[model samples]
Target: MKHLILCCLLLCACVAAHAHKPSDSYLNLVVEGQSVTGQWDIALRDLDFAIGLDANGDAAITWGEVRARQSEIDAYAMARLQLQAGGKSCPAAVTEHLIDDHTDGAYVVLRFRALCADTVSELQARYALFFDIDPQHKGLLQLMYQGQSSTAIFSPDKATQQFKLTQPSRIRQFVDYGREGVWHIWIGFDHILFLLALLLPAVVVRREQTWQAVDAFKPALWSVLKIVTAFTLAHSITLTLATLGVISLPSRWVESTIAASVVVAALNNIYPLFRERRWVMAFLFGLIHGFGFASVLTDLGLPKSALVLALVGFNLGVETGQMAIVAVFLPLAFYLRRTTLYRRAILLGGSILIAILAAGWLVERVFDMKFLPF
Candidate 1:
């Protein structure tokens, strides 16, 4: 146990020893007629984006023209947008982001308007800006003339130009879910943590729960299977509800509560909390994580036609990720079970790490700052 704990810390230390890699974001813009919508896939790559307004709003605007309009827009518009790189989480991604607006798909505030001034509506197009994808970004847009909120998803073909929404709007024909579903499954940090917490108990065999809990340390894979199955089934149920708009929760509260669940799960690990029916815990916590999944679809604005498909795809991505983790951990835990040291080290060290992470998250969310020094 002691050696494994040391090894884990040493591994983390070595990784942290290197400069942390920056996060990249890719935003896909779909401007249908007059309504403009943005979808992004947050990643480790620098952000690339395009303001794909399908309108000929302008004839042409030079850098000078765009720079000049900046002030006019600031003065006349009720809202102002400040361009920040990366996302809301990081403030100084300035050097990392290489922003350009002179591309074929780039939208120039004045140039586009100038080019299309003669017409009532002209589609101004700008695509392929390599930048970060931030969902809560609003300042970039000042006022939407007839912007309608809708959801979008990438076509399975992956060749379609645009996507459609769950609820058909009065004006919008197609919506853009873009790569957000895959993106969330990939970068949703909270979802990852919840899975990790639930995963911990599965890796070990409680001496109390099994007659062979400590045998060659290969107690039984059945426990892990049961837990994973329960989690998958439970979350899938709510993921649908949350996505379909049948239910909802305050984002902050849901997120905070998830962190809290991790703490509880970790505590249980040190001294079995859900001793009888782990499924109950799985079902309850899985519901919360499912809501986290729903938020991604909710943000995209589900399409009535694509709801089932979107749900299936996103859930599949999640299960794939979850199953991948199990595949990695199960073998390691199985091997370690042979040694007395393995069980102690894994439970103690794993529990501590989970608790620390969950507690840090709790402080970060509840108090807006870290309660403990890093």
Candidate 2:
């Protein structure tokens, strides 16, 4: 069982390293009468992965390299998306190509126009970009119709969506953004790992270079509550502030620091630097993690009129998802606390492994390099 657990941890660490930054592309579409015009911003790193934007293989992509392959980029992207109006295809064409920067990295911006045969009341979009190469990639869509906006997330499971070219529904926006928040937390392996590193020792008390399971459940529960509450409060504060544009940080710095925090949190388990006071680590690191969470909302561009509602819904969704994780993890961890597997194999051995994985993530995020196979 211990070996099986170790294997699972190793596999999870490998997978989490690949998921340091979830893959995503942004699309903004406008509908008017019988025409649709929009811009799509896809990460240059993703584009390079799909179509080899770095021609000379110097590990750096230049404008010359991207310019030379404009045609290929157009063909590759446009072919993957199809717009429909009133059940008829509105053949699309790319009008311009440019570069833009998002919180994550540089993006390839494609401005295009699509015309239909008649007036459009309802619009359908088919998006399959990068699904073949990177199944985890998601397309984030923002639609502007009749002076209102709606957003949707497209992935391999749900590649097509329809939008009504009418007044926006605030409820719809709230629900959609909420679901997105939940999805973001679920796939955020780095965030999950960081939280787990903090929680691993919650049910146990550290004493003299070793760990022992607590005698009662109340103390363990209280310990978990403090850690979770601190993390939630910290991230919630920053998530709101960052999403509201009150403050901002570079994505690379935020991501690198988040990874470093994970390294410290996990290493502290083996080293017992903070011993019983893990909540301090959670609150401090969670501030950086909140910035990481804000990337999705920042890229989607929050609704002006419904800013507070959207923010509340997204934050609630994040909390709901986080609580669900704790629900599952707390029980299992409490059960395992009394075992030798938990004290020696998981706490000691697992912390060392998590630290190593987080270290790799730190190197990757800070240096902007891909060392893992995935």
Candidate 3:
């Protein structure tokens, strides 16, 4: 029974790992001198989203729902935005006017108002929008600005960017769409793991290459760098292509193939399958990663004109994610190379772990097993 429970536990862990998301993010779109610098924070939540069309015909949190959950959303957004806004802080002298609003659904109707002050010159704000459904449900948002209507669809249900101050006289923002609070971290588990896998191998590769020649330590690091650069270049290429919708592949295939990649790399370690042409493998695997990125853009439902902006923003998020993965793993590789014992342990342990994972995934994906789905 203990053995059976262990198997079940492992099975559940795998599912949970794969089932994870990047995080519930908090977005800050700061407009400076007619330019924008966006930063993000992530969080989690047990709430649903509320959607209502703005006066300009943009989709936003339902006004009624806003009134009901105003305190909840505001309290949630305040702490983060306050820190992010630095000395700016929340706006003063703003009037909250309740306005009646309606939506496609009966429950979508509600009354809410914008809190703005003309004399404030800047606005910092956050609000929770609940839809009584998981963010994974089908969702879309439409906004009207300068008499032009724009739409953003986020299928598989997710939060959105906020418009704190909409009036032209008070053009300011505090919280951004798609960013929540700390909750975002837990949701993005797969994103973290995928990034970890990518960075992990390069770090290991660099360390192994270093011990090959006693005097070639620096050169070994360079080789590792070359490999990392190659991988980055390859993935970045596909990330752009996939996000732009130029290259489309089935999500299942991409994910399944991703698991296969870990397998391939593990096998290569045992015997030089790719044989010094690992960059080729990285490039090929990157194509798959790019497809994974496309899945995110697909979720965003960005418009064609804003396509470039959204594309850049989403890609930036991915780049930051990749950099973080490297930051954590690279230095550890250097440390491991210092001791032969540690090196062997890493090799044996990492190889076995990767192989087991790959095997589990291959079984689940290739055969459509009920136990685990990679």
Most accurate candidate by TM-score: 2
Deviation in Å, model 2, residue 190 alpha carbon: 1.8
Residue 284's lDDT within candidate 1 is 84
lDDT of 3 at 277: 61
Show where candidate 2 strays beyond 4 Å: 2-15
**TM-score: which is higher, 1 or 2?**
2
lDDT of 1 by residue, 19-93 (tens): 111122223334334333333332211211222222234533344444444444323221211111122111111
Worst 10 residues of 3 by lDDT: 169-178
Model 3: per-residue Cα lDDT over 1-374, one tens digit each:
54334333322322455433332232323333222233322221222322222324333335554566645544443332321132243332212323321111122111122322232333333333322344433233333343332433333333333332243211111111122211222344444443333333343443343422124346445655655566567766876787666777766677677667767766565555654566677677766756655665554445454555555555555555555545545555554444453344444444556557666765665564425432
Model 2: lDDT of residue 355: 85
Q: How well does candidate 1 score on lDDT at residue 26?
A: 28
- Displacement of residue 185 (Cα, Å) in model 1 is 3.9
Report the error of model 2 at residue 220, Å.
Answer: 2.0
Worst-scoring 10-residue span by lDDT in model 1 = 88-97
Alpha carbon lDDT of each predicted model:
0.47, 0.84, 0.43
